[model samples]
Target: MKFPISWFIGLRYTRAKRKNHFISFIAIFSMLGIALGVMVLITVLSVMNGFERELRERILGTVPHVIVGERAQGVTDWKSLEQQVLQAPDVVAASPYIDSTAMFKSSYAGTEYGILQGILPEKETKVSVIEDYMISGSLNELVEGEYGVILGAAMARNLGLWRGDKVTVLVVEGSTVSPAGISPRYRRFTIQGIFETKSELDSRVAMIHIADAAKLLRKGDKVSALRIRVHDVLNAYMTSNYLRANLGEDFWVSDWNRSQGPLFRAIQMEKTMMFVLLTLIIAVAAFNIVSTMVMVVTDKQADIAILRTLGASPSTILKIFVVQGSINGVVGTIVGVISGVALATNLPAIVKFFEEKFGVSVVPGDVYFIGFLPSELNAVDVTVITAVALLMSVLATLYPAWRGSRTRPAEALKYE
Candidate 1:
């Protein structure tokens, strides 16, 4: 029976010849290396993607989306500005703010430095995301009441204060400068309730009534800034631009992207850099593919001479070796894609399982944000990684495939 081109020759080329055990082992190692490299890259990238997502949802969602404020001076006619800003596209709400840094003495007589954010709770939902983040107590309580305070969970722990506790703010509101340098002003406040954001902000920030904060901070009716929340996060920048264009020269609007710009950019750069460096591991494995194919070409020379004499073209010989090399490449690529996707898809559960059983930590929360390896499998990422690995594998086969095709029937059959 006349055999098919692939069956008659290609199958024979890929088979593990009994005499070249070392070549077979090299092929196995190359495939394994590719599989491992692809798996690790996919897993790590997914974790980074997960981190980015968490930052946006948990961190940004808990923070203000935009801040509209004056330059070094202060906002004029804020209610008017609020109306104008609200007219911008995607602007959901606007809240006036009186934010300051001061030292607060707890009930235990121990004091610590922190941020005091004075906001009108009634209007807060218009501008800040904080209202939705209320784990306890009403924002109305923080607004209508005098000297009421809301403390972050971590800040409450550090200061040793609780609801209904009185804490005094020792403001260095620049001295009543005598003949001396300065004398600090003191402001007293009552802790209203504790709030948790589960972010770094929770450890150093406190919230209070804008009216009360103005009274205590000696700012009168003047709010330091205008906090604005948008309906869509992606349109934040465009809305900010609209506000900036209309809100006069003294006022400026900044969106979440501009506010968190540097931090996110750093993450993106670091992830890209690390991924590039890790790809060298795949390159090393491709070199193994080269080594294996070279050895295969040497071991299969006599078979090459027989084929050449039987009218197989040099290109046909090349295809035979190419197919042989690509089998290792294709097999490794397929297995690696499967393994990587599987590991990425189930990474969180797998880590949890191991943690429960062995009490071992794959990631730590204090060191890394919300610890335990988080994996978010992106299909595009998998495709890109697999394509790159296959490219490297194909490149590695060139020299050996060419060498196999160029083998002379005379010399190769002389010792047959």
Candidate 2:
């Protein structure tokens, strides 16, 4: 089988044994460096992708996409407002809720401050994932007059409270005015259910029936806010604007971006910084390619002279070297991509294994937004990484290949 002269020569040169052992070592090192760099970059970026995905599915899933409320006071006619908001485009579901800050005290534990939410059990499932995360009992048990409370898993553990245990809830805004001074309003609630999301929210949020919440907050038939879920969460900001315009100036519309935007933005910024920093690894590997090619050109000067004496052109010499370096880039990139994808795909299981073996949590449920590592492989990110590596590899070959082509047959022959 006949091959093109340039390609045939290039392939032979790539596999040819070099007299200098150091050059061989350098070639191997360059390939390994590129491979390692590509692998690490893919793995890290996948983990970052995982974090973003978890934020969307877990955090955003729990929080309302948008909240519409009266600017001056709670919404007294929330049912009418809910119907109105639901009629707006992109809005899928709406639920009325009462929110307040309260201190929970258990007989066995100290007081813990948390956000207390009042939700209609049947309607809550339409807006939040709380019902899906319930570990024990049921949200429906939170009867309107029962004064039952559903505590987050971590919160329950912290307060050492269990189902059927009674806890005291003190609301600062609902304090009573006395002859001497104002006293905090308090109520007793029976622990009816516990939910676990393995997030920070699990340690900071508690829920009860909206009717009970209104009574405790001293607000009759009124809700603090109307939580609305949209068809596309990413378009919540635009939907919020639409709601604001449609609902008029009497109400204020807020979206998840206002509440959780900073955290989301920080994650994105960090991902970008990491990509920039890690690209330097591939660049360094490319430099090694430059060094390896330079050394090869020096060792093959006599061969270049012989080829030139036999009528080989300088352009042919350039193609040979470029092909050799590109082969290295292509092989390293292929290997790295395969290995990196495998590692990233199973990162969560690997993390869980180590955590169980070591009996220590890398991501604690009470601290981070998620308790386990998450990984997502994006095609765009992988393509960008591979392209950047190949481009760098090709660029690194230019100076050395050009110098090799510029070799003078007469001068090279005289030295030989």
Candidate 3:
């Protein structure tokens, strides 16, 4: 195939052995730097994306998207409120829940503090992923009036409690007045099940039948709140507001954003900061391209002079160097993209392999909310990274190419 003279000569120059070997080394180094930068940036971004996805699907799935309750008292008429909430736009499911802070005392492990949630097993399935994460027993085993509790995996382990074991739950409320003073109410509950979500919730939360919780809290036939799930989780804030307006002034609505928004925001901020920091690596590589082109321009002055004598225009001279520098950018970017995507796609396996090999955990579930590394490569992110790299490459070439183009045939040849 035929090629433009500038392109052909530029490529030939790239392949040619240089008198100054250091220039060739710098050229190679620049390409490798760009490749490494792109690869790392893509992999890190993919991991961040994975974390965000897990948070939305796993953690958010367990927590209510929107919760409605009476501002002054518990929702005594939750069944009626549930029906109303289900009618709201974007709302998909609603379940009555009772919540309280309690201390669980195990015969073997002393005591632990936790947030207890009362849920209707049948209705709970419509709103959360708790059933899917059950490791010991079924949610159906939590019979009404049985005083059975489902403990989170971490919480259970910490308390040395297992299914069928009995634990004492002490609630600070519902004190009994006596001659001496008031006494907190307490109840003994059998452990019916255990669940693991690999999230912080697993260490700080427990569940029981809503009916049992109501009795324990002394709020007969009432619940603390109504948990609602929506079809579009991103629109939960708007849905909460809609519930507040439609449900009247007596009820208050709260969404996941109010309770968990800061954590998600911090993750996003870290991702942005990481991208900015990694881009500097690519910038430094682009600078190397500039330096390489400057040296090339100096070395090829005799050739530029010869070409000008043979009727080559300054524009042609500029095109030659631009094409040469851009080749480094394009090749490096392609390699980086291929390697990055490959690594991101198999990151989980890679992490597992290293973990098994070293006998150590990279992402401990108790600490990081997940036991393993996650990755999800986004096409838009890859495209943006590639475009930025190419732009920097082109920009780096301009100055050296302009300087080369201004070489006068008479002056450049006189020294030779």
Best candidate, lDDT: 3
Choose the strongest candidate by TM-score. Answer: 3
The order of the candidates by TM-score, greatest first, is 3, 2, 1
Q: For model 1, give the 10-residue run with minimal summed lDDT.
A: 4-13
Ranking by lDDT: 3, 2, 1
Q: Give the per-residue lDDT of model 2 (tens digit) for 1-416.
A: 87768787878988998889998888888888889999999999999999899878888889989999998889989999988998999998999999889999999988889999999989889999888888898888999899999999889999999899998999977788889898888899999999987777788899999999988989898899999999999989999999888889899999999888898999999999999999899888899999999999988898888888998899988888888877788787888888889999998999999999999998887687678898999999999999998998889888888999999989998956
lDDT of 3 by residue, 241-331 (tens): 8888889999989999998899899988999899999999999999999999999999999999999999999999999999999889888
Candidate 1 collision pairs: 93-126, 94-126, 175-183
Model 1 lDDT on a 0 to 1 scale: 0.80
Q: On a 0 to 100 scale, what is the lDDT of residue 348 in model 1?
A: 96
Name the regions of candidate 2 deviating beyond 4 angstroms.
Answer: 1-5, 309-313, 350-371
Candidate 1 deviation (Cα RMSD): 3.2
Q: Write down the lDDT of every candidate, Cα atoms only.
A: 0.80, 0.90, 0.91
Q: How many backbone clashes does candidate 3 have?
A: 0
The deviation in Å at residue 156 for candidate 3 is: 2.3
Instruction: State the weakest 10-residue window (summed lDDT) of model 3.
Output: 173-182
